[model samples]
Target: MLILFGWRTTIEQLRMLSLVCGHCHNQAAHHLFRRRTKPTIFFIPLFTISSRYGLQCTFCGVSYDISKADALQLGAHV
Candidate 1:
């Protein structure tokens, strides 16, 4: 068996891609954090992640994956 560590950030970056809306083809921005009540627990902290790039249209919400590569590309562009 193999064990992998120190990849939490990478996993998160990949997961962010799913939020992208195929219809809109625009990156969704992180709006705000909302508190959610857990079924087992009384209170739980939850966050709403969105994209801050691309155009947001009515078709749907789109969010792009912000991987390390993407960050580097953005830095170079700037």
Candidate 2:
């Protein structure tokens, strides 16, 4: 018998916030997402091994890796 195991990362959009893009210099909507990497057994997610976050621009479609504090600050609606 053979067993297949591996690691996989799942990305999910958690929220949307209005922010200005530095590269494009445009005030537009941005999306915040959560990345969870888990161990997979036979193509089934077993447990989360690591977690991360990111931000993506809605207009230019540029993505960025950001810290938790920065993500919260940028997520503020004003």
Candidate 3:
């Protein structure tokens, strides 16, 4: 029997916030995202193995990692 199992990562946009970009120093909208990694069996995803949050500036395209607490508060409205 052949068994196939691996990990899959998926990124989802949680919400958007108007904030200043750290790199470009421009006031613009930043996209909040959730990145989740899950174990998959035969292309079917199982429980999440790990999760991360990020904020990306729309103007400069620079991305930064955010804390879970901040992500929850910002994503609550969405």
Candidate 4:
């Protein structure tokens, strides 16, 4: 018998929302991302190991990690 277990990481662009860019210092379209990591058993996700949020400044081409709540708030279209 053999047992196999591993981890998997996936990066996905959640959405692009209208948000103020700190570097640009103005309202602009920004990209939101969700980086998810999970434990995999037989290539199936067993459970979530970790999750991260990111905000990307399209104007400045910079991206940084941010809190999920904060990112959501800032990502809200207004």
Candidate 5:
């Protein structure tokens, strides 16, 4: 039997906010994202392997990790 399996990472944009970046200290738009890694078999997703949340600054392109609760709150648009 031929078995193909791999892990895939999906990044979803949650929301956009105007805030001051901690790294660049510039007032700019930031994008919140939810990143999920899932195991796939035969190109079909089976289950999630890991998950992460990130907040990225548009101008500085700096990314910061955030809590899942905060990501859920920011992603209320769903």
Candidate 6:
């Protein structure tokens, strides 16, 4: 899965780290090997003033600003 924020990518590269065998008697487990799937991407707009910026996740009620870099280290792409 790839997550893009502006020009920066959260998951730049992906590899199947590991695979586990499914239960032989489980019907749901049989479908686990299905190939095609689509990923859902969520985007939230942030307000920037001067060099300061504020961001909030719409999915979750998490509010943060650029000034709080020590706690939330947000990186900007040049």
Pick by TM-score: which candidate is best? 3
In order, what lDDT does every prediction score?
A: 0.31, 0.83, 0.89, 0.81, 0.88, 0.29
Pitting candidate 4 against candidate 5, the one with the higher TM-score is 5
TM-score of candidate 4 to 2 decimals: 0.68
Model 2 misplaced regions, further than 4 Å: 74-78
lDDT per residue as tens, model 6, 4-70: 5532112111111121223222222111111122333355434332233333333333434435342
Residue pairs with colliding backbones in model 6 are none
Residue-wise C-alpha lDDT for candidate 4, range 1-78, written one tens digit per residue: 777889999988888887788887878778888888999878888877798988898888878898888867765322
Best by lDDT: 3
TM-score of 2: 0.85
Better by TM-score, candidate 3 or 2: 3
Error of 3 at 74 (Å): 3.0
Clashes of each: 7, 0, 0, 0, 0, 0
Tell me how far the alpha carbon of residue 46 in candidate 5 is from the true structure, in angstroms, after superposition. 1.1
| TM-score (C-alpha) between model 1 and the true structure | 0.21
Report lDDT (Cα) of residue 67, candidate 2: 77
C-alpha RMSD by candidate, in order: 12.5, 3.2, 1.6, 3.5, 1.7, 17.3
Give RMSD (Å) of candidate 3 vs. truth.
Answer: 1.6
**Could you tell me the lDDT of residue 11 within candidate 6?**
19
What is the C-alpha lDDT profile of model 2 across 1-78, one tens digit per residue?
A: 999999999888878988899879899998888788999989999988887788899999999888777767766321
Tens-digit lDDT track of model 1 for 1-78: 653322111112211222344565455543211122222222332333332222222335433433445444434231
Q: 2 or 3: which has the higher lDDT?
A: 3
**Alpha-carbon RMSD, candidate 6:** 17.3
The candidate, 1 or 3, that scores higher on TM-score is: 3
What is the lDDT ranking, best to worst? 3, 5, 2, 4, 1, 6
Two-way lDDT contest, 2 vs 4, winner: 2
| Candidate 6 global CA lDDT score | 0.29
